[model samples]
Structure formats: C-alpha cells, structure tokens
Target: MTSMMAPNAAGLSDADIANLAAHIASFGGAAAAPAAEAPAAEAAAAPAAAAGDVAAGKAKFAACAACHGMNGEGQGMFPKVAGQSADVLADKLKKYRAGETVGPMSAMMAPNASGLSDADIADLSAYMASL
Candidate 1:
C-alpha cells in the first residue's frame, strides 16, 4: 500500500499544512500579522510632564520631520500625525516604546520611540496635536 500525501509535502505534517493554509487565507494572500496590544501597565501610565512645552516638542520633532514632513503632513505611505489628540498620541507612543506592534508602521516607530521618556512623549504629543 502507498501512503497518500500532499503534492508539496516537504516534511511538514498535515496539521502544519492546514495551519499554514489558514494563516495565509486570513491575510487574503498577504502575510501580515495582527497588531499587538500594549501591556496594561504601560498603557495606564500617565504622561510624566503635566504640561508639554510646544517649543521642546518642536525641537524634538526635528527628528520626525523626515517622514512626517516639517508641517506634520505625512509623506507617501507615512500617516499624518498632526491634529491628533495628545492622550491618543502619548498612548500610541508608549505602546510603540514597549515594542507592541500597533500598526503597519510599528516596526519603524518602535526604534524611534524606544528612547523617549514619558515626558518626551508628552512634549511630542502636545506639539503634534498643536499642528
């Protein structure tokens, strides 16, 4: 008797093939993973500075201008961040700093946000919101 196997079988178990098929199907042929959630503690942490300085935020934003534009109008695939709420921006930054994949750009943002403190997030958020 001959054992029937899948045509593309290359040491992968039937279950493994099924799982791979499911994953591929979920993305409609694209291989994107779902966004990760932020840790509860990190998500709950309040902004370090009570009031953010727009000047400081502007200074800090110099690094962000390359992709976001000097006026915060995002270029190409980059999303526009200007006019976002301070709280929302801070939360997203905190999530990025914690290495959570909040969006498609999380990989790029994680490195940039890693060095920011809560105070820095506040300042940056304030500046971005002002725009």
Candidate 2:
C-alpha cells in the first residue's frame, strides 16, 4: 500500500491508511474466499460489495449492456466492469460525471455519466460487482 499510494495520488496520509486498516479489521478484514471463487484466470477479478442494492443495480445495468457486454465482459478498450470493486466503479463514475478524466475513455464515459445521480452510480456499481 505504501509503495502504490503515491503522495497526492489518493490524498492519504500514513495515519489515514492506519485508520482505514482498522476500519477493515473491525469487520474481520477482507475475506479470502472471494478470490478462490473464480478460476486462475479470474482469481483476482473479484467485485466490491458496497452499501448498494444488487437487485436495483441489476435493473440499472441493462443500459450498460450495449457496450459492456451482456454480462459486463468488456472487450478491447472497454474494460470489464463485472466483478470489479464497487469502490473503484463508483469512484470512476463520480469522476467521469464531474468531468474529470481518468483515462482515454473519459470523453465517452463522461457524457454517459453526466446525467447519472449518486444513486444511479451506486446502483450501477453494485450491479457490476454482482456480475
């Protein structure tokens, strides 16, 4: 974590990391079971389970199926969203909606996210994670 979290990147201090760690520990830490659920090729392709509703998220994901594939199996430049971290998904959506560029696809994603409210992003993130 120290090596990957460069200063000014995510704005986290050493204390902040410690606090986050404690928070995670409070919940018994991350489970190792999820990684084992998939095969070697997708061992690390797990998803995040945030405080969003999976059912609602599923309904909201329909519109995203066109480009993200029916099951969120992204192809080419469209990165896979299925089994992705909820935090990561929500973060990207929020960033895109705010007109912040996170990558080459920002131009296309930004407009798509512009009209999305926080609820929509959460629902979408939850839905994608479940995939």
- The TM-scores of all predictions, comma-separated, are 0.63, 0.61
Best by lDDT: 1
What are the RMSD figures for all models against the true structure?
16.3, 14.9
Q: Residues 22-95, candidate 1, lDDT per residue (tens digit)? A: 64344343323334565678656744334778788887886676567778888777779899888888878878
lDDT of each model, Cα atoms only? Answer: 0.71, 0.67
Off by over 4 Å in 2: 1-49
Task: Put down candidate 2 lDDT per residue, 25-127, tens digits, no spaces.
Answer: 4434332221122353542453333567888878667556545766999755577999988878987887787778899889877756766666778888988
TM-score of 1: 0.63
**Residue 18 in model 2: shift from native, Å?**
50
